[model samples]
Target: MDAEHIRAIAQQTGCTHIHPGYGFLSESPQLASLFPEGGAIVFIGPSTGTLRVASDKMQSRALAVHNGVPVAPGAHVSSAEDVHKFVEGLGSAPFPIIIKALDGGGGRGIRLVYAEDHIDHAFRRCVGESASRRVFAEKAFVGPGWRHVEVQIVGDGLGNVSHLWERECSVQRRFQKVVEMAPSTLPRDTVGHVIEAALKMARHLQYKSLGTFEFLIDDHAKHWIFLEINPRIQVEHTVTEELLNIDLVKAQLQLSLPKASLEVVLPAWTMSPQPSPPPGYAIQLRLVAEDPHKDFRLSTGTIGPADVFWPSGRGVRVDTWLSTGPYYRGGLQWAVGVDFDSLLAKIVVHAGTFQEASARALRALRETRIAGDVKTNVEILSGVIAHQDWSSGRIYTQWLEEKVDQLVQLGNTQLTRQSRGSLSDTAAPRRLSGGTESATATALLQPGASFQLSLSPSLPQAASGQQTQKHTLVISSIGRNAFPNELSGTITTSLSAMPLSFSLSQLSSIMASAHTEFANPADPSHVASPIAGKIVELHPALETVAGDANKGSYVRKGEPLVVISVMKMESVVNAPASGRVVRVGRGIEVGNIVAEGALLCVLDVTDMDKGLARL
Candidate 1:
């Protein structure tokens, strides 16, 4: 919530407490100072000193090291020159070190350096990123394998704290965790050690409110090392809640003040481990606002006109800020108009075991769709779900980076097929009527004339490589008053009529054995707006086509018809080909869904004899 808006509401409702829920101003020292002087609002969190201690990575590391917590061997370099000095001292250090930002939130200001060549570049990048994002840097940890485990503990404002087990956050993309599960795949004894260490760290710092102690578990050695302590609620809090059955939020709100200890019993301390394992599995995939095809490029803006199918079962929960309808579009795209936002819709699942829960989550994601100019990363997510490495729990942090190429190809292929408007397997096209009219052997005819024309072969062959097929039309005077000397009503023709182009839609219908009409391009009729996007603007049209070509204008195929812009990118409307307009609507403009082949304007190319003879 906006601070000012919350303050306004606080004044109206006479509310006394303002609890900042993690991130932003939640951990700010100045907020605590400012709120009290205002007289009404009381900020609920740790004091200014606790925040200051927890905010700096170097200080936290030193504190943890002093308390007998195992930590990675990395030096904090204040400048590029300092990095060189640190590098010199480390004569035989291993490659592929992680450089982290001191003040970075999330994984934004981190870099993984592989070799000596990358050292300088990595240092420079981290320095710039940290400075700009207000983060600091740390050297990477080299181990056989690495697993991220986090322990959650809440203080009673006095001193007592309770543990809420640990969450395994090993699965990642670009160093950012995408999937997290409670009760890591680590051994029971290992978990117990980590939990005990976390409590010690918490007690040492006298931590208060909801906090998580992070650790990097060594792959081969089975050793856990303290990384840092997040003195606020984490994004993966739901996972802890699922396994522990504890509402950290409610607990935080209730025990925020400097109150005495409560006698309430917490939920079952930790997840129970079977002698073998659980009956099923639970896996979660983070649905970020990104295009997985484009190297997982952050797709900023309203992510969807989507439907939220809440995954249900004994262990399914969707913690999202969206609901049914277009209102729930994700991501707050700043450049475009308002109505943009992204969320960490924590979709959780519980089953007899891990495999079942993973299956359920996969199925739920497959059923999801976003109806708008925005596209989703569904394909990549699905790929990850089906990946053997992921299924077997053999995934690493570099998994996504390795599979980026294949995922990009697959996603792009899907987009190409979707854009072509090929709704089905059949690629054949239908034909339209009134191709051409023959010249009369006797009298001259004006260009503006509507004639009922017949075709020798009503349907034309499929359009092949820009080579157009011709239709022979026979046209004659309808009444004796119209043509006095014409033989009967239909005049015998020696020459064939000019050819009229049939659009993809018309060809489709004819191929499907449907009745046909003449090709009329001028029908400013709307068709199904094939692709989905926001309508930006419609160009001013000066000409309108009527059914009769001689009396009205004709629109050529591939001519600009309408435009729909998706995600701020513009797309144009076009005429299929040269055909007479039958009925163009005046109100047809931007934001209108022109159903496939809906008539635009009416046009009659009846002077086929004159035009065809020329052809």
Candidate 2:
């Protein structure tokens, strides 16, 4: 992550030229400037002086002030007192404040303080969260329809700059861009101002090569404020390239050449031979293997076969870092772990109109199926492009957070139905002959139906990602007659190639057995563990705050019975209903390891049903 480590690698690999790309050392002035001392390697980016000012949010804010660029009114706050001082300086800039990492990226180190009381905690949290150990406070840009617009700039080493228009990066989650579109639709004068501001900063810093100037467009106030300067090629660079028929990375390389000039750098893109600026619109969506409903946590575990389809022809392009599908690990099963960024690919579409491009991109995503139970954000992507706000170009940075629930629901239904249909495709049995229509699933599972299923041996490969152990295989073959209604295949997650026979009459039972998860909550007879965790707090069924254990006292539903800590998250085991605890779990203490479905304590909830229903 530091310059020395990267330098060591460059030396070890004998690379004469190094591209820091976007994260880590991309904005490190120390890395960029110090690398020139090596004399053998060239860093394809801005000068150390430019990056020094651009990478530091505080310094960048100062630069904006000098250039008369509008910036969100705020200050560099190192302590709680400084936060108050900056807020007081705003006068009428509202109460809530936002604390940000001075050098953080990807929205990792940011906290919004909603009230005066939370400033201390939020400031402390932000300080610890930021890798640079520096935090800045800014006037929270509140109100509706706040958008993100970035101007793409290419500067020669001589303070000369050219603009490639702007990009709308309004659709975001966690303050990070999720979808980016070029040729942003904004007021013409306002767009021109943004471009002018970007070029001014580039000239001010003598910025060279590729860089992006980010801004926060407050639609309510009809104003745009300076945010930061990304002194490297960005993830959404493809959008601008698609609209202009240019290669930005190649341009970055050309800038580092001897006696490099704009015309000499990329004649086709920036010279006389350059064609007219391409027309139409282009939209790009970053597809990641994450579930939106679950707070976009890592979906690292079992990875099944990936049936990725990259659309050909026209303006459709999918750029991915992973070439092949996930493979077996530890000589057992297929899986993908959280070793790298969850970004699986970027889907870019260029068409005659925005609607057409949006439609085309959606089609490509739905078809680019990553098979198995691998959860992805495709359905979320689908919802975004099709949403009314997005279609009207009225999106904001928090649009994804606002539409998370609706998007997740749509995605769940789509994915669940897809998985359910996969079962139908995989569980076909006896074929009917001399008939026009095919047999229904019910007919196949009826008596006298014969079918065959397939299975694969569990084989492991050398672990490459973060996880080493074998993850449970999500998909397993099940022929029509191979499994009966009584027996299910869900029990064979780790097993491989085991053949079994069952009756067709057991279809209903088989489906239930294969799909049933955890323990049934409908039956309160068994108070099993809902998740694998440790019993960090075992309380009496009914206890007085004065330290009296009332064993026979009635426990109300939703009352905390046990507290379990799993993976740093705490989950409370609640009383299912108003019932007396028959017995406290034996040997269960403040710290006892409990597996999922492990018995916690028995509850006499005979009357809980009626009481809970009434409640």
Candidate 3:
């Protein structure tokens, strides 16, 4: 909730407490400590001091260092020149240097600078992501197999701090966690170190309610470095709850409420004054509405009727905001928007052994179906859990990046051919008679013109490599899930007088297939927009593209030429031909509305050297 909204609602409803759940005002120290004139509502998390120190990445790192916790070697640089000078002293290190905003969390406002050429762009991008203009850098824990381990610590506001084991959350993409598991396979001593460090931090801060102390375990799994403190309940809190049988939210409320003792709530506390030892194994997979094969781009749409099913038996749970609804038209609909986190739901499973829990999770995922046109990461989760590396516990942060191709293939297997048998079989396209003028909607007919056109098999095969098989597009950036596999009338053709009505039978027979690859690398003939959206980014003069290294030079295939965004889903338009960009759209600027199939630029196939000779 916004700060104004929260205060207004509290005043209006006479509410005395604000539990922000996880995001928005949850971590805002200002909001947590907000004291309007005569307004006194308890913020159910931490004191202003704890929230303030833990909010800044640099400040939290300092706290960890002050508390004798091992931290990764890094520096806080706020400017691009500072970054250049910082990297210069590193002396040819192969590991990527990480740049992060001082006031960023949840993996946003972060960048991994792999090479010198990318530093300026990454630095600028990171700085712009945060409002504070304070960015920092660190040598990334370059991995053979690094792990993300964070301890769950809860405090009772009176310096009586306790930790409930650790969670392994290494599987990530774009520096954000996608899958999380509990009770890491780290040696007991390592786990002890993580828990001890967490308790020390919590005791020092006198933190109240639920919070997390994140860390980075080195590739060999020997060294551990304190990362940062998330002073709120996390998205993966379910993993810890399922394994430890403790309700963290309840704990938070009890601790935050007036005069609630930790000992009274923890009935099974042992003689050591700590909660009973943690038990069992658990894993959680975040079900996000994005195409992992297409770089995890957001798929915002009103999900159509889906035959939903949760895993059977015990120790399995499906937590989602989707309300109960029928699996038919005119029923409960999930209108997925781009305003919040892409995580639509989470599948949490628990069992006595890690292998048993993993097996159950696989079964659950296989049984689950999200039907309709929304692209989901369910299959990707399925692939990761069932992979051999995950079973052997030899996984790391970059493991998914390395095995993305195979994992995608594993996911693509779930897309089997489904019968699209409609109202009638073999029905022709509905005809619209216009005084004996046989016009086809699909033909190359201009305004007020009519002619017959057909897909001729005898035409010369399209320029070396081309997509010959016509496809019925199944989900789109704009249309949502209303008409699955129906054409949206986006075609680029230049001929005269031909139009025909399209048939549903033909479209259904065309079948639904996902071309998951990022851009068809096989050179394209024209530069066109694939979807109706705004042109978010256009290229500068291509010096390396042309042979002469001149401004606005030619480019080879697969180079990023243009970028278009529709409803927050961004698609990069690559050069389909090895040629110089001859013509750019007159008003092609950032935020300019563009129609699908609208030509953005024209490419001249003539190579620069040959063109120079002709000149």
CA deviation > 4 Å runs, candidate 2: 267-278, 302-307, 325-335, 409-615
Q: Which ten residues in a row have the lowest lDDT in candidate 1?
A: 504-513
Order of quality (TM-score): 3, 2, 1
TM-score of each: 0.60, 0.68, 0.76
TM-score of 1: 0.60
lDDT of 3: 0.67
**Best lDDT among the predictions, by candidate number:** 3
lDDT of 2: 0.66
lDDT (Cα, tens digit) per residue for candidate 3, span 1-615: 478777788879988878888874677888876743234777888887888898888899999999999887778896888888888877777458899888777676788888888888778667756657798998888566688889988777789877777899988877778889998876667677788899999999988888999988874748888989999999899998898788888888888667776676554442154443466799998888777755676554444333344455688888976536464445445555444567777989999998999988877776555543346888788889878888998888888877888877775564332134321222212232221111122221122211112222222343233222322233334433322232354446533233332222111111111221112223354576554455666666332333232334556666667766544334567777667776564445676655433456667776566544433
Q: What lDDT would each prediction earn against the true structure?
A: 0.54, 0.66, 0.67
Whose TM-score is greatest here? 3
Candidate 1 residue lDDT tens string, 1-615: 355666678778988887877655575555555566236666676656667667667777888888898877767776656656666665686555666677655664577777666666556445544533333344465433667888887776556666777787776765677778766767767777778888887777676677888888775677668888777888788776665556777777766554534345343323223222223444555665555644443343232212223445567777765454477334332121211233426677655556666666666664444422223566666566556665676655566667766654553444343334422222212111322211111233322222223233223543232344323222333344333123343335433344333211111111111121233332334333333334444423314332222454445555555554433223455654455444554334455432222233433345334433433
Give a tens-digit lDDT track for model 2, residues 196-241: 8998988998878999999988776778899899899999999988
